[model samples]
Target: MVEHGKGHPDRLAQGEQAITEVAADRLDEDGRHEGRLVLTPDRIYFLDNEHSSGGHDDVIDHTRFQGAEVTGDDTVGTLALNWSDQGKVYEGNTLELRTFKDAIDDQLNP
Candidate 1:
């Protein structure tokens, strides 16, 4: 898992800036997979190291981001991202999830 506050700015497109990122367990119908959740100016995406082929495993444009829900406490938990018609859940440290949610909210409202 990605350490708290660590980010992958190099993964961004040219001129794209990263707000924050974290290492989390992506919970899918298939199972949980280790990946990094990245927040950029234009989108939030997951980079699944186990299956990556030089592209995001999944992406949600900022325009499609509805909101986020954090379940758990200060030590550990899950982060649920609400999108246009669906949502995604990621399990990680509570502090990192909260920070990521706050960053997304700030961008949406800023």
Candidate 2:
């Protein structure tokens, strides 16, 4: 579950994980704004700007969504940056965002 200050907890589905209350500063190298995100066990999720709840007030000039991937297995996994603007929902145990995007593109183009 992910939650912010004084806000209700956002529930995650079974077999899913969430990175809640992510400060925007954590999103980038420099600490500039407040930003939060929720990552399911499979995919990373970006909340709507409104849902950012004034957390990302300083994160201007950014895209609506960015791509991400998870490496490793059930014992442990690392999240890494992948693609940008690739509309795919995460399910589980996939660490190559570009590969997923390619598959999606091929399916759409073919």
Candidate 3:
């Protein structure tokens, strides 16, 4: 796929700009490789660096984003970000998840 900053070239819309992106550990599956989560002004993007089924990048538009919540703590283990989109749920971990999610949430919910 063509590259567009931190996301795929085919994933963006006109005038869409990436606000922030971070490397996240995919905790929803076993032996999963780390992925990238990109936040644009109007969407949340999950880019798979390497995935078992050969790969797929997920985009959750602001209207489809439900919420992102911390499901664990650094003290106990890696912090996990739990989020839902259009009735599907996803989980990933990143030291930056909370911060990134908070910022994205503001833009999505405001």
Candidate 4:
């Protein structure tokens, strides 16, 4: 996972660039799979892998996440980032404090 100070510029660029082999995976219960894609001023992270884990792996590679459409709630903020290639959608929630802990676990075992 990629961690940076709040409002890091690299994190912001991730939302705008075309990243390849961006780590993608799915949770057991259809929840989101959150992790970092790259480390730098511009990083791209993903929250959910529901679609990619299914039969859309190639679709995700073809599409590039450009921006997010946010839907906020009390506990979390959901985002649907638009992809450039296959019109695929990358769905995820805004990063939270606990997210870092989960990412650490994955790194140790992954």
Quantify all predictions' global Cα lDDT against the true fold: 0.79, 0.35, 0.58, 0.35
C-alpha-based local distance difference test score of model 4: 0.35
Candidate 3 local lDDT, 1-110, one digit each (tens): 11235545345566787787766655544555566767788777777777524246666777656666555556222433334523323344434566676777677768
Error of 2 at 19 (Å): 4.9
The ten-residue window of minimal lDDT in model 3 covers 75-84
Q: After superposition, how far is residue 2 of candidate 2 from its true place, in Å?
A: 7.0
* Per-model TM against the reference: 0.83, 0.26, 0.64, 0.32
* Candidate 3 backbone overlaps, count: 0
Could you tell me how far off, in angstroms, the CA of residue 107 lies in candidate 1 after the best superposition?
1.1
lDDT by residue for model 1 (10-94), tens = 5556666666788888898989988888887798878787864645377888888888999997788999988898988999999
TM-score comparison, 1 vs 2, better candidate:
1
TM-score ranking, best first: 1, 3, 4, 2
Best-matching candidate per lDDT: 1
Residue 55, model 1: Cα distance from true site in angstroms:
6.3
